[model samples]
Target: MSIHTFQLHDLEIGTLHDLLLDAVSDTKWKIKELRQTFDQTDQAALLEKLSSIEFNKARLETYTELLEQIDSSWCPDE
Candidate 1:
């Protein structure tokens, strides 16, 4: 087996928070598009895709909430 090496650095909370926000935005857009597609189509596979997209949207929203909480409580005023 081969091994991997990497470097570590301090946690950039602000950057992380921004990334979470972006993820939430992207997921929401996808959910919106999928919903529109779902409304236009009448297929089982499309339903499944919508379900999956909604699930992911929920997960991203949850993460965004958590990040907001952390930013409010832990991050200092800027």
Candidate 2:
């Protein structure tokens, strides 16, 4: 599998939020597909991958919530 690299600082919060949501969705689908085809030999590795993906998803959710709060609370001076 190939991992894509990005300069996260270049992206706006909303863009990053969208990207993270897409990533979480994709990773979750991959996890579900892998679970369907899992065997005894793949159990450890598969579970590890799923756990990592879940952790990332949780982190993304936290970040998204934080961004939402910031967006809602922030007030720009006119």
TM-score of every candidate relative to the true structure: 0.47, 0.49
Worst 10 residues of 1 by lDDT: 1-10
Model 1 lDDT vs. the true structure?
0.60
Residue-level error in angstroms, candidate 2, position 72:
2.0
User: What are the clash counts of all predictions, listed in order?
Assistant: 0, 0
The per-model lDDT (C-alpha) reads 0.60, 0.66
Candidate 2 residue lDDT tens string, 1-78: 334444534547777678777878877876775676475557777777777677667666656665676678668998
Each model's Cα RMSD: 7.3, 4.8
Local lDDT at 1 for model 1 = 16
In candidate 1, stretches whose alpha carbon ends up further than 4 angstroms from where it belongs are 1-42, 75-78
In model 1, the Cα lDDT at residue 65 comes to 60
